[model samples]
Target chain A: MTDISRDVDQQKYNQALEKFVSSVNGNTAFDGDFQGNIKPYQINQRMLALNVLRNNFPTVEKILGESVFTSLAQVYGKYYPSTWWDVNIFGDQFAEFLASQINSAKADAYNWALIAEIAQLEYAFIDRYYYPGHDSTPEVLIEFSHFDYEAQQLIKENHPNLVITYNCLDRFQSTANGEKFHSSHWSVDSSQKSKLKIFSASVFRQNFQVVSAFSCSTANL
Target chain B: MSSIDSFAGKQCSLGVEYMGAGLGLRFPHIYEILSQKPKINWLEIHICNFINGGLNQQLLYELSEHYPLSFHGVSLNLGGPEPIDVAYLQRLKQLTNELQPKLVSEHACFTSFDGRSYHDLLPVPYTQKSVEHFCRRIEQVQETIGRPILIENLSRYVQYSENEFSEAEFLSQLCQRTGCGLLLDLTNAYVNDKNLGISIDAFIDALPHQFIKEIHLAGFSTHDEWLIDTHSAEIPQEIWNLLELYLDRYHNVSVLIERDNNIPSFQELYNECCHAQSILDKYPS
Candidate 1:
């Protein structure tokens, strides 16, 4: 068997760094097995991953309640660190991370799922923002066809996150053909680029009314 | 001009082009920005959120036809040693092609390392090694987008003992080396001054100010005896004073007022923008 902790080289230094991170969250204890000084780069990477999780999942951070969340995120980051240039992709496993914590099973109705969904929505927004060729013209609308089955068949291709109800379908049927249906309209100014990707969903705010949620997606029409 | 454009214009009248004095557009204020139709110069939206299948697509067509917009990003992480996000850059390139924004900017700091991202804008150590890293990244980004990238100075609470040069020096070198423009955040300079114990003027003097494509002014907070760039409060008097000094020093500079948190009423922001306009007017070329 290859001795993983005995080598006094870059590989050993990397293992030591991983061990130090694991030790932060009680996963592994440091044994002073490696040689040389601690690297600033290692310290920075550990801190940055922890910070990304902390920022992206505010609710999880709240549930873990600061100290515990910080500690766990630090640990989780070491093991399943982000692989993307954008930090927004880091909190993908936050829901799973939260589930592993004590008293995690007793979260509120819109707790983990809500946060996960919201984070997903946030990520979708980011993805859409970065998506190219998002044409701003109304000519890109999906055709609603009563005669041709193939036209409305495209509904299956719509984003799964897009909230669709029998009522919405009925409303759409009621609207005249060739007329754009805007249940809710949010504007993006000229200086700004619009990249919403998720299909509209219903969100109930303080008003206790179901509201449409816009998606961020690829700009390519 | 439309009521919206005029309102946005009144916010930041550079007396030339209309990038407008704008606030970081958040989800909460979408209604107010649209309904009130306030005469603000421009609105800055996050590039990450704006292009995705959210409000950007839902409203962009209508909004773009009406008002001017700009992009402010936090995820570029230009100072990192890791490979840049090509997809993100591609999307940004597409968004810019569509939006044709007057200005698009990112921080001078690195937000990620080793693939994992730190969402906050973390400062880059001002050293020759870091400078080279940033310049190469900036060149890549600008090349990909086919536009000059405006790099903003970050407000850091902690200073690394290993940093060999001042922030301004590093920025000047980066611009000179990469041909990228500078987005001088005056408030960040103030924060660095207090926390890192550097003179504000010395920080200003070190940089080649003529290459500044834009300026960002925002408010900050103090925590644990350290000056933090929270972007959540009103611009402090001292920072505003510093801004005035900067405007006086650099004529014909495009300045922006950034309010990312604890955002006040639109009228209040417009009022503050008018103050910025008045300052710029006082130092007109």
Candidate 2:
């Protein structure tokens, strides 16, 4: 082909590819002027989205059950699309997506607030696992007994990364029902009636492992 | 002469040192590899995994101290319509400068378009226009990094109708135009042979042999009528035979045994490395 014709052909090829990508991103349907079949491409996009969600949100998947979770994830993937090069960040907006879904869900069927809280907790854990700041600084060994009360208060105020938030009431109920924290098998129980509460705890990383303090209310912080 | 005999006993002209048989480094095996210290010649790592400074960075630094490492990237998106990402390239350049790996490589495919990343290696159409586009981006990458990058052919399921050149011919011309090297992936060639009905031997022979700097051996899974490059299984006998053929032809090219999913025990992976080493041992390099 001549140089001009080759350029024209390549332009057409790029346009078709962009169209196909748009289809995968759920912006439009797969209708492009290309010679090859689009089914395989579609399959690849869905499989990738499913795999990434499966990796990042095992807890959410278990809570919603695999079938429902996967279907919801497929729809969420289409609307959100992947904006990051790293698959680690692909499901960053999943908690928000789940919250939106819960808002529209049947009120009498499931505990949407509890589900949304679980999603937020799982997303935070994943984010912290990959967060560079977690490993960037050396762990400070603060001796509370040696410090004055004012000094301790100053330290608590300055060390913001040490604080972790959780829904204490849900956690207590879930544990009473024989569920372990950070366990993927945990499911919400509708039988127990309790008020929702928030708590903050100081978390520490020693020897490359995370340890959380006993739960405390926001008033303590 | 038989196809294998045609290029037998020939020395590779790529000038890269023979690093012998190596394996891709994975997170699960990091501690075991460091503690046990397997008897492998070198290692290859996905550069993106170690781009951020953290536990992986610390582990990679220790691994580099023990073994000669090579960086293989998945997100260069060299064949995309947009220009190569400057910030990504700068990160890569910084990494290469710090690590000084023996060789650096990326796919001859695009992974992103229009500011959205698919996070998968999307195939480029085999056309003169594509060749020009890919070569221009590759040249830019090489200039930014201060080294020639090896481009690996992708395992493709679909072929565009406007392709003006065969994949092999396009790769050969790409190397000639951009001064890059080829990272010949035997499993991808084998998968394409099954799905696209292209002759593996012909495809291998058509490539510019002198430009082949490294070889990758991996396994693929079968999904219905298509052979997907899942990299989750053991090396098939057919792919092993193809690697042997390539080694017989080009004696100095480095070989990597890659397993990303369904990762086996370190001993099992080492045995595969030993298998490749046994072939390399026959060539008297």
- Using DockQ as the measure, the top candidate is 2
Q: Runs in model 1 with CA error above 4 Å?
A: A1-91, A94-210, A213-221, B1-20
- Model 2: residues >4 Å from true position, as ranges? A1-10, A19-38, A106-108, A129-221, B1-15
Q: What does the lDDT read for residue A115 in candidate 2?
A: 58
Clashes of 1: 51
Query: Residue B202 CA error for candidate 2 (Å)?
Result: 1.3
Angstrom error of the Cα, residue A195, model 1: value is 32
CA lDDT of each candidate?
0.59, 0.71
Q: lDDT tens string, model 1, B180-224?
A: 667788888887777767787898888776567677888886666
Best by lDDT: 2
* Candidate 2 residue B224 C-alpha distance from true site, Å: 1.9
Query: After aligning candidate 1 to the native by TM-score, how far in Å is the CA of A109 from where it should be?
Result: 12
In order of appearance, the predictions have TM-scores of 0.65, 0.78
For every model shown, the clashing-pair count is: 51, 0
Q: What's model 1's lDDT at A103? A: 50
Tens-digit lDDT track for model 2 on B1-285? Answer: 543332331223234677889988886777788877877799999988777654456567778878889999998888889877787789789879988999999998888888778888887678767888888898899889988889998888767656778899999877777778899999999888888887888999899887788999998888777888889999989888887777767788789999988988888888998998888888867
10 residues in a row with least lDDT, candidate 2 chain A: A140-149
What DockQ results do all the predictions give, each relative to the true complex?
0.13, 0.24
